[model samples]
Target: MSNDQLAAVFNAGIREFDRLTPQVWGPAGQSLITQLRLRPGDAVLDVCSGAGASALPAAAAVGPTGLVHAVDVADDLLEMGRLVASDRALHNVDFVRADATEWEPPSTVPAAGYDALACSYGIFFLPDTDQSVNRLVRLLRPGGRIGVTVWRRGALTDFARAYADVLARHLTGPAPSRTDASPLSRFDTAAALTDWLTGFGAHSVEVTELSNLLPATPQLAWDLILGGAMRAPLLGLDDDTVESIRRDFLSLLTERDVETLDATTLVGTAVVTG
Candidate 1:
């Protein structure tokens, strides 16, 4: 699906998405920022920053002297981010609604460019993952930090297959998995992610696995469907059809004994060579 489509889906399910923040998005975002080790005065860019998950934490790390531009296509999500920033009195972070692939530095950014860049669980959404990220990395100053979070190999396999099986009954299309042609397939593992980052204008690559295993509860299962990219499949379905799908999906999870949602993520960070 396109980024615009994704924005629509996410915009329609903002509540569900935020509900998963504590168990799903929050940890990975924190880990990514920690790995990057943003300084107090660093200028940062966080793309696909849903509700400012990583961006908020990055703002804290960068403090008042630094600035963080959280860019995403979803306006509602960005509004949620703005609210969170206001609540926290975090004036350094600005959540802007824009296509991250074409995001440019603002006038306030130093001419040398951003001191660090981060994208938590977002690279897969880019049409040309490598090219888009390569461009973002080039926006950074020499030796600046670049970090990304991605699903580790086998992460959410059971949940995805179950969701796809349910979808197959309602829709017509091959289930998208980590096939050779898929962008995610290129760097789901630590070794592959290391090499992928190195291929770009980055070095000193570090890949850390953030093992996040949450209980496979009915609420989380449905929230995952509505909140994240998986929601794309249910775009045109009516409420009744969605309810049916949800019922079947949860039942299938129970039948398959998928007790844990493997949210295992790989947080990869590197120093951009510029």
Candidate 2:
């Protein structure tokens, strides 16, 4: 999809960030957090921090002296994140509406520098993965770290296979291009992900696979795709196509089988040096 199309689809999911943030972000982020080894008063940057999923936790981890700048391209999502911060009385967090792919670290942040940068399940959308990694390095202090999450191979997650089947059945025209074929998708594997991170000047890189159960139920899966970031490609489909896709998804389920979905999360981490 073109950049505009991707943005529109992602923007649709921004409205549901408050409701879907937990499910969408959960285990996918554990590995990243594990790698951070956050310290008191450390500065952190959360790129594509929709509704402050990682930002809120990072803010808490960093304490009063620490600062977290949560950035995303969606203004509405940032607004929601602002409300979340306000409700929690968190003064350490700042929500910035900006394109992570193109944003540069502010002078304040650069001078102070960050100990870590976290991008959870958001790198897939950034076409220039190498450049984004380089920018994250630039935004960090010496020996700073980077943590990222991406979808694992399709076979690892039944939901992924189901979705691919849904798309194949619904879309008649030249099979809508695979979403994972994007330039960044090359990092789906541990070897590839490690190589890319190392290529960006990382000294030590690690990759981990995380899997969890998604709420089972056709409706839950529907909500997941329709109400979350996955909504992007779905929103692009025609109504009839959507129904057909939905039916295909339902057909794949067994008794109450629709009540739970198997999902896996892939995480990659690296530290910058030299």
Candidate 3:
């Protein structure tokens, strides 16, 4: 999909994404910042910072003297982040509506480079993962730290498999093929992520798994499918087909007696060595 289309998909489901962030990625971000140990005057960069889930916390950690530049492609998400920052009286954070992969700091930010960069659940979205990591590294000064989080293996896999099965049986048009590999799947394991980060010129690479058992109900499961990445595939389908998929998907979940959503993320941190 084109960038605009992808942005639209995120925008359409911004509410759901925001609701789930606190339960999943928010804690992961907290863990990341805790590891980075931001100081009072540290300058931080948050790439693909959706609704300031991580950026706001980073701003709080950096305090008034520090600054955080938050970048994302979705205007709505950026605006939401700005609102949240304002609500918290966090003037240190500046939300910019731009592509995280190619965006550079404007004059308002520090010139040398950011002291730390945090990208929670976003690095995998870029078309060129290595290039994007390189870009992020370039924005960091020597000894600067970069932290990233990606969904771990088996993260919502059962739910996705169930949904795909339902979708395949219900889709009116030819159903899309299920690929064994997912873009984000590459970073599901710590070893793979460490290797990727090392290849991207990150030294002292450390990868840790953060898992959360999120309480889930049938309704919440349905809402998740409608409000997250899976939403994109369901778009443009007839209402009947959509409802049927949902019904079947929920039925499968019920049959399996799945009560909790396994939200797992691989949090990777690395430093730039001169």
Candidate 4:
């Protein structure tokens, strides 16, 4: 999908995204912050800072003295993040609407560059992943750290397969492709993630696994897909077709006896040696 198309889909699903934030993206964000070892007064750049999942935590972690610049392509998501920050009275975070793959920080951001950069579950959408990584590295000061998170190989595979099976049976056109071809799949493993970071000139690359298991009902599974990454695929389909797919998808889940959702994430961190 084009950038504009992706943004529109995300904007439409912002409400659902917000509901799932605490369960899916929230812990992943915290894990990224912890791995980056952000300290008080540290400046952080949260790329793809959707709904403040990571940015809000970074703001609290940095305290009143520090600043966090959160950027995303979806204006609605950024606005939601702003409200979240306001509710928390976190004046330190600035949510900006911009493309993570191509945006440059405004002059108001720290001239010395950021101390840490965190991007959780957002890198795969970039059209040029390597170039984006290089740009992020350049935005960091020497010795500054970068942390990224991606879904692991087995993470949600069963759920996804179930959904696809149902979708294929309902749709008359070609079945939607699996997510395995996504750019994020490149870093689904620790070794690949470490290698990618090192190739980007990041030193001391480390990859860790975070296991998140949540109680799953068929409805919850459907909601997750509708509100999250799967939103793009459902676009342009008729309501009847979408509902049919949803029904079959839920039935498959029940038949498979899937009890919980395992959204295991792989977090990779490294420091710029420049």
Best by TM-score: 1
List where candidate 3 sits over 4 angstroms from the true fold.
172-178
Scored against the true structure, residue 126 in model 2 reaches a CA lDDT of 72
Please write out the lDDT profile of model 3 over residues 102-156, one tens digit for every residue. Answer: 7877775677788999998888677777777787789888889888888887788
Query: In what order do the candidates fall by lDDT, top score first?
Result: 1, 4, 3, 2
Q: After superposition, how far is residue 134 of candidate 4 from its true place, in Å?
A: 1.0
Model 1 quality (TM-score): 0.97
Q: What does the lDDT read for residue 95 in candidate 4?
A: 95
Candidate 2 wrong stretches, greater than 4 Å? 1-3, 14-17, 110-112, 155-157, 175-180, 236-244, 253-260
Better candidate number, 1 or 3, judged by TM-score: 1
Clashing pairs in 1: none
* lDDT of every model, 2 decimals: 0.91, 0.72, 0.80, 0.85
The model with the greater lDDT, 3 or 4, is 4
Model 2: lowest-lDDT 10 consecutive positions:
172-181
lDDT of 4 by residue, 108-167 (tens): 567878899899888887778888878887998889998999998788888878877776
Better candidate by lDDT, 2 or 4: 4
Model 2 C-alpha lDDT per residue in residues 99-176, reported as the tens digit of each score: 787767776564847889998878766766677667767878889888888866652255655676667666655444
lDDT of 2: 0.72
For candidate 3, the lDDT comes to 0.80
Per-residue C-alpha lDDT of model 1 across residues 125-222, encoded as one tens digit per residue: 89888789888988898989899999999999899989989888877787544456778878899999999999986889999999988999899988
Pick the winner on lDDT between candidates 1 and 4: 1
